[model samples]
Every structure is written in C-alpha cells, then in structure tokens.
Target: MEIFLQQLINGVTLGSIYGLIAIGYTMVFGIIGMVNFAHGDVFMVSTFIALIAFLALTQILGATSLPFCFIAVLIGAMVLTSLWSYMIERLAYRRLRGSFRLAPLISAIGMSIFLSNLVYVLQGPRNKSMPPLFNDVIQVTQGGGYDVTLSVKQILIVAVTALLLAGFWLLVQKTSLGRAQRACEQDSRMAALLGIDVDRTISLTFVIGAALAAVAGVLYMLYYGVVNSSDGFIPGVKAFTAAVLGGIGSLPGAVLGGLLIGLIETFWSAYFSSDYKDVAAFSILAVTLIFMPSGLFGRPDVEKV
Candidate 1:
C-alpha cells in the first residue's frame, strides 16, 4: 500500500507534465480539427532553449537565485517556441490551410522531420544532461506502517500545472478572446463572416499551444535532468494518446486523461512490469476509443440528415 501511494504521487506529478503538453494537442485539434505533428518537436526545441538559457545564466555567467533563473529560462523558451509555432502556422500551415487536407498533414509531418533533425544538427544527437534541481523530498508515513515519499519538485509540478490550468480555463471560458475562439471552432467561415479575425485567432491558438508545450518541456527536463534531440516523439505520442483519451477539443478532458494515463503508467511499472508501461498506456487508449470514440468530455457528431 505504501508503495502504491508513492507510485500514485509519482504518477500525478508525471501526469501534470503530460497534461501540459496534452493541452497543446487538444487545443490545436479543437480549433482546426487537425493534429499538429510538429508540436512535439516544438516542445523539444523549447527544452533546448531552456537548457541553453539556463547553462548560459548559471554555468557561464555564474548567476545565483535558482527560482529567478528558472523563471527566466522558462519564459524565454516559451517565447521562442511560441514564435516557432506562429511561423509554422504562417509559413508552413497557413498557405496550405484551405487546400487538400493531405497538404497540411504532409506539411506537418515534414515539419516534424525538419525540426527534429534541426535539433540534431544544432545540439548533436547525444543526450544533454543537467545537474539536479529541486531535489528535496518530503516523507509521509501512513497508519498502516508504510512510508510514502514525495519531492518538492513533484509538488512544484503539480502546483504549477494547477495554476496554469486555472488561468487557461479562465482565458478560454470567460474572455472575449475565448468567445472568438469558440466561434471559429464551430465554423471558421461563419466566424469570419461575423467579423472575427479567423486567421489571427488560429495563429493565437498556435502560439498558446506552443507556449503550453514549452512549459511541459521545461518541467520534464527539470524532473529528469536529461534530454535528447529525439526525445519529443514518445512523450508527444503519449500526450496525443492522452488528448484522445480525454476527448479532443475539451480542455478539462485533456487534464483528466493526462492524469489517468500517468497513474496507469506509474502503477503498471511499479506493481507489474516496467517494460510494459508504455504498452499499457497504448492499450488503454485503444480500449477507451473502442468504448467511447468521442472521448469522456467530447461532444458527439451531429449529422444533419
């Protein structure tokens, strides 16, 4: 039981990071109904940005104040990645937007390849390692006489995820910008007819999605202390699985699905076999789709006869 509790903590913490990346997937899908394949690579790039920025600040320049340095690196990564996303939408995706659906799909795939290799060329193919940050642990002992362990980093991940999610929810639900976004999601043509800037909205969507992905990238790097040029693909796929399991286009569903996937992966590794954890997450995705295709919080297709 104690072990279970400990794994639970780990799962939630990992899930929070997944949830952050999943938001990027779900948001872009909600607005445009297309998967952004390069998004995962975009996340990888963000991590690199954070790594370089952190290294320059702490190692090269000899700066103190860990919190401030982390914040600066995180923000810098988010901004750079957000620019990358915007350009992707503009230069690669925008021109192909209304064309054959396959055009954008292929473009995204090509972009993914391009970005991954770009990182490979720039940063080399080796895994980049960092000194551990936020290594403090908090221990808990239940009445059953088992000890459960928690870390400050884990707590930071959960808290930051919660806060960001709350702010994002408010932006999507309460703001005028949110209304414009929902309008475009329903029908881009109609939204444009109603005087909304459809293109700008889509661009903003990309920016926001990339920003969230950037945050996930930084958090994951901090937690693991190691990153590679090709590291984005697996987590990206898992996050996509999470987006699907939670129901694409639904914000809260993404978080819920992320947490569930995290728990399943963690518990499977702990009690069953570490080797099959990824397989378990994929299986859950398949089972969930078979049972409920629209996702837990997604709306059903309304066909007009």
Candidate 2:
C-alpha cells in the first residue's frame, strides 16, 4: 500500500508534464488537422530557455528569491517559446497549409530535426544540470515499515498543472478566442467566410500550445534537475501517445491520457521491470488505435460530400 501510494504521487507529477505537452499536440490537430511534430523539440527548446533565464536571474543578476526567479523563468520561457512557435506557424507552416498533406508532415519532421540539431550545436551534446531547488518532502503516511512521501516539487507540479488547466479550460470555453478556435476546428474555410481571421486564430492556437509546452518544459527541468537536447524526443513521443490515446483533437482527453500514461509508467516501473515501461505506454497507444481509433472522447471524423 505504501509503495502504491508513493508511485501514485510520482505518476501524477510526471503525467501532469506529459499532459501539458500533449495539449499542444491536441490543440494543433484540433485547429489545423495536422500534427506539429516539432512540438516536442519546442518543449526541448523551452527547457533551454528556462535554463538560460534561471541562470540570468541567479548567476548574472544575483537574484535570490526562489519564487520570484521561478516565476520570471516561466514567463520568459513561455513568451519566447510562443514566439518561436508563432514563427514556425507563419514561416514554416502557413505557406504550406494549402499544399499536399504530406508536405506539412514532411516539413514538421524537418523542423524537428532542425531544432534538435540547432540545440545540439548551440548547447552542445552535454547534459545541462540545474541546481536543485525544491528538495523538501512531506510525509503523507507511515506504516507497515514503509513511508509514503511527497516532494515539494511534486506538489508544485500537480498544483501548477491544475491551476493552468483551470485557466486554460476557461480560456477555451468562455472566451471569444475559444469560440473562434472551435469555428476553425469545424471548418476553416467556413470560419473565414464568417469574417473570422483563420490565419490569426490558427497562429494563436500554436502560440497557446507552445506556451503550455514551455510550462511543461520548465516543470520537467525542475522535477528532474537536468536536461539534454535529446530529452525532447522520448517525452514528446509519450505525450503524442497520450494525445492519441485520449482522442487527439480533444483537450480534456489529452489530459486524461497523459495521467493514465504517467500512472502506467510509474506503477509499471515499480511493480514490473523498469525497462518495459515505455513498451507499456506505447502498447496502450497501439491498443487504443486498433480497437478505438477515435480515442475515448474524440468524435469520429465525418467526411463531407
């Protein structure tokens, strides 16, 4: 019971990160019907941005307030990563929107490669480590010769995720922007006919998605205390699986999938071999695709005559 509780805590924290990244995938696909394969790399880039921002705050500026520094780093990473995603949408994806579907997919792959290599060149191949910030743990329970503990970082990760999701959910459900996004999701051409700026709406979707990815990146770095250029690929893939498993175009579904994946990974690692954790997560993806391709909450795609 103690082990189960501990793994549950760990799983929720990890799943929150994955859900943040997965929301990016689902939002983009929801809006434009294309996967931003470079998204994971964008998350990767945000970690670097966060790293630099945190360093600039502490090492260069001599700032000492941990809370203030974390806030600044998060805002900086979100803004810059949003800008990067915006440019990618404008320059790399905008022009290709009317082209063949394969063109965009291929372009996305190229962008992913470019971002990874660019980071590799700029940051080098070495793993970047940060000074640990939240090492304190709270004992949740103690019994049966075992103790269940939760770290400050875990609490922060879960809290931040819940808060962000609440804000995000409101943004999507209550705001005009959300309505516009829904319009575009239904039919971009029809939305354009209604005087809605399809391009701007789509661009904002990318921006929002990138901002979420940035948050995930920062939290991930804080949780793990280290990062590498190659770090994006696996997490990105897992997040994508989450998106797909939950129904790629459904935002709430993405989060649900992420939590499930996180729980699966942690529990599997705890009870089973650590090596097959990835296999277990991916297997969920395969099973979901084979038996329920539309995902748990995703609507079936309707073909227009």
Candidate 3:
C-alpha cells in the first residue's frame, strides 16, 4: 500500500507537467483549429533559455545566492519565451489564417523542423545538463525508509502548475478577454459579427498557450536535470493525448487528463515493466476512442446540413 501511494504521488507530479503542456495544445486547437506541431519545441526553447539564464547569473554573480538565481532564471525565461510565443503567432501562424487547413498544419511542421535544427546548430546536437535549482533534502519517513525522496524541483513543479491553472481558470471564467476567446472558439464568424476581433483573440490564445508551454519546459528541465533539442516530441504528443483524453477544449479536461496519464505511466513502470508504459497508455487511449470517442468531458458538435 505504501508503495502504491508513493507511485501515485509520482504519477500526479509527472502528470501535472504533461497537463500544463497539453492545455496549450488543446487551447490552440480549440480556438484556432491548429494542431501546432511546434508546441513541444517551444517548450524545448524555454528549457534552453532557463539554462542559459542560470549559467549567465552564476558567472556574473559568483553563485553566491542559488535560490535567487533560480528565481531570476525562471522569470527571465518566462518573459522572453512569452515574447517568443507572441512573435511566432504574429510572424508565422498569423499569415496562414483563412488558408487551407493543411497549409497551417504543414507550416507548423515546417516550423518545428526549423526550430529543432536551429537549436541543434546553436546548442549542438548533444543533450545539455541543467543546473540544479533545488538542493534541499526531503526524506520520506514512510515505507521503512525505502529511500524515498523529494526536492525543490517537485515543489516548483506543483507551485508553478497551480499558479498557471489558477490564472487560466480566472482568465476563462472571469475576464472579458476570455469571453471573447470562447466566442471565437464557438464560432469565428459569429464572434466577428459580435464585434470581437477574431485575429487578436487567436493571437492571444497562442501567446497564452506558448507561455504555459514555456513554464512546463522549465519545470521539465528542473525535474530531469537535462534537456535536448528533440526533448519536446514525445512529451508534446503525450500532452496532446492527455488533452484528448480529458476532452478537447475543456479547461478542466486538460488537468484531469494530464493527471490520469501521469499516474498510468508511473504505476505501469513501477509495478509492470517500464517498456510497457507506452503500450499501456496507447492501449487505454484506443479503448477510450472505441468506448467514448468524445473523451471524458468532450461535448459533441451538432451540425445542420
């Protein structure tokens, strides 16, 4: 039972990260109907940004205050990445609007390849080691000291996830901007007729999604302690799966899906064989499609011919 509980906690932590990235993918898909193949690479860029910030801070400040350095790195990464998100939308995605659906998707794929190659050229093809932001010791007193441990990385993951979730909830539930966003998603033409700027709302959606991706990226780097340019692919695909599993376009769905996937992956690895983890997740997904294609919270769209 103790082992089960430990695995459960591990699953939730990992799931939260997946959920964060998934929300971005889902939101973009919901609002703009774009899959954003490059979303994962955006997370990769954020990780590199955080790493670069830490290195620069340590060099200039002599590493006197490690905690302060962490805060600075996170803040710097968020700011620049948020800007990067805005720019990508403005420069690339914005142009493809109203074009053939395949056009945007192909463009997104092109962007992904371009960004990955750019990072490879700039940082080299090898994985880079991330600096430790949390050095505190956490000793679990349960399970007979099976040597269970926690660290600042876990706390950062949870705290940052919580902050982003709360902010998202407030944005969707309480803000006029969010209302405009929902209007756009429900029907772009109607939203445009209602005086909402569809283009601007779409832009905001990408910015918010990218910013969340950046946050997830930073957390991932802290958790794993290393990152490579190709890091985003699997997680990005998994996050998209989580979004669909929870119910595409549903805010709460993203969170629920993320946690569920996280738990399944962790426990499957712990109790079963690690090699079967992907198989288990995909199997569940296939079953879900067969049994509940709309997902846990997805609402069906009705169209009149």
Q: Determine the backbone clash count of candidate 2.
A: 0
For model 2, residues 210-271, the per-residue Cα lDDT tens digits are 99999999999999989999988889989999999999899999999999899999999999
User: TM-score per candidate, in order?
Assistant: 0.95, 0.98, 0.92
Model 3, 1-305: lDDT tens digits are: 66786787688889999999888888898988788888888888888998888888888767768778767877788788878778878877898988998988898888888888889999999989965657685866544747566666686788889988999889987999999999998999999998999998998888788778877877887888899988877787778788889988887898899999999999999999999898878887787767876788877646589
Q: Rate the local accuracy (lDDT) of all candidates.
A: 0.89, 0.94, 0.84
In candidate 2, stretches whose alpha carbon ends up further than 4 angstroms from where it belongs are none
Give the top-scoring candidate (TM-score): 2
How many steric overlaps are in each model, in order?
A: 0, 0, 0
Name the best candidate (by lDDT): 2
In candidate 2, position 296 carries an lDDT of 85
Q: What is the per-residue lDDT of model 1 for residues 1-305, given as tens digits with 9 covering 90 to 100? A: 78888999999999988889899989888888788988888988888888999999998889899999888888888899899999888988888777887888789999998999999999998999999999998877756667798889989888888888898889988999989998998898999999999999999999999999998988988899899989888788788888988998888899998998899899999999999998998898788778888898998757799
- Pairs in clash, predicted candidate 1: none
Between candidates 1 and 2, the TM-score winner: 2
Residue 124 CA error for candidate 2 (Å)? 0.7
